[model samples]
Target: MTPPASLKLASHEGRAAEAAPGPEAALAIRGLTVSYGQTPAVFSADATFPARTMSAIVGPNGAGKSTLLKAALGVIPRVSGEVTAFGRPVAEARERIAYVPQRASVDWDFPATAGDVVLMGLYRRMGLLGRVTGAHRRTVRACLGRVGMADFEGRQIGELSGGQQQRVFLARALAQGADLYLLDEPFAGVDAATERAIIDVLKALRDEGRAVVAVHHDLSTVTRYFEHVLMLNVRPVAEGPVETAFTAEALDATYGGRLAATHMDSLILATA
Candidate 1:
């Protein structure tokens, strides 16, 4: 059954959380809560992302998808929570995490070329007084090449198309040489080709024994793109492998009646 364009879900049955021991988790969050003055954004959320896997954080708008990412990263203050990256406190493992924020939140007009942007990712390794060296330039080129933006390194960021800019930002994150990647809506506004390019790089990273997590809004791509999923509606709804957790029941719970009955039916039938 082909669903309407409005219906966006992939077929996957819910499964129990794995009980067997595995490798150390790439990220863990316990009792996470965030508020905006008088209102709570995320409430006592708990999630775990495993090593060498790609996970998607999915929920409806205003469900605190981005809020969860920001709070976990300490970009925004959390009311209560314990977050760990690779079994260590976030502060202690900061260098092992690379973050790519929503493209819309960036200041593209800041006078910098694509190469300059990627070079920023290497600043930590260069130290306070260290200048850009030949090694750094090679690294920058390599990162850009990985994202297929090598030729555009000299282009001003503000002058590029939306997809081009996104690729450059991803290149910058790649230059960080982090073990875990956190991306907030990496595919939000890009052409199919650019989206393909980004996901390919991300999957390759996961295959290399790194972890990748993203605040993903498109349900159609959830099971296809990620191995694990964290469903949310302010608080956690369900979480685990996409094969088991990306079920219609989880979507209904996470969306909280926002998805119509017709849509839900379509999802079930399509998946069935």
Candidate 2:
């Protein structure tokens, strides 16, 4: 389903966030760089994800898509650059942001129930030593219900299917009560039904005027699920509306000499 053509980006850049144009952006990163020892994962790149839009960070493997998220969230130390949320420093705005890492990165065997995982999202708001009050638990339960996992709260996450586990994580993010959601490939391995459900939830978030930025690999579905796109390959290739930024030219630059047809072929075989 294509979005209404009325969506715009100027309001996003009208703030004092950066000279880059967008103001009051849900997330704004400038000159972001990350490296490990002598290896540079990402060079200077800038992108401002506007509120009320879903932006897909698209690129080939090793384009530093995941690194950008990690660096911005401070999960990993950055080499240099700045990341802000709602025009505030990243740390100062932490409480208002929720991140759902790739499902593969978790330890499924960890002895934790679905509810336990969802409640974890509240750690920042609750303070490191804060207790989980009954009200907080109720909120967790309600979040699970919103994601269609109310009945599975007590189930072990390790025992759930991939799709179910993803839903549980989505529920956890909802419990964060955030204004921005950063998801790393939420649709990578989900079933068709699960994919549809996730997209619906994402669109619902956008409807409520939240920003959703995801690291996505599916060229075919990028346009279908995202309203805006930030094409990346170590550095930014393009950043704008999905229709405008996802052109053959930009995609070519993002993939770095990799043709769009080749990527389409790979995607077809991969999903097959």
lDDT of each: 0.86, 0.84
lDDT of 2 by residue, 1-272 (tens): 32221123344454545644233578888889999778788888788787778888988899999999989999999989888898789999988899999999989999999999999988877988898899999998999988888899999999999999999999999989899999999987888888888888989998887889999987888777887889899988888877666777777677766765777555434333
Q: After superposition, how far is residue 18 of candidate 1 from its true place, in Å?
A: 14
Candidate 1: Cα lDDT at 201: 98
Residue 166 CA displacement from its true place in model 2, Å:
1.0
Candidate 2 — which residues are off by over 4 angstroms? 1-12, 15-23, 260-272
Q: Give the TM-scores of the predictions, in the order they appear.
A: 0.90, 0.87
Q: Against the true structure, candidate 2 has what lDDT?
A: 0.84
**Could you give candidate 1's per-residue lDDT for residues 78-165 as a string of tens digits?**
9998898987899899899998988999889999999999998897799788988999999999999999999998999999888888
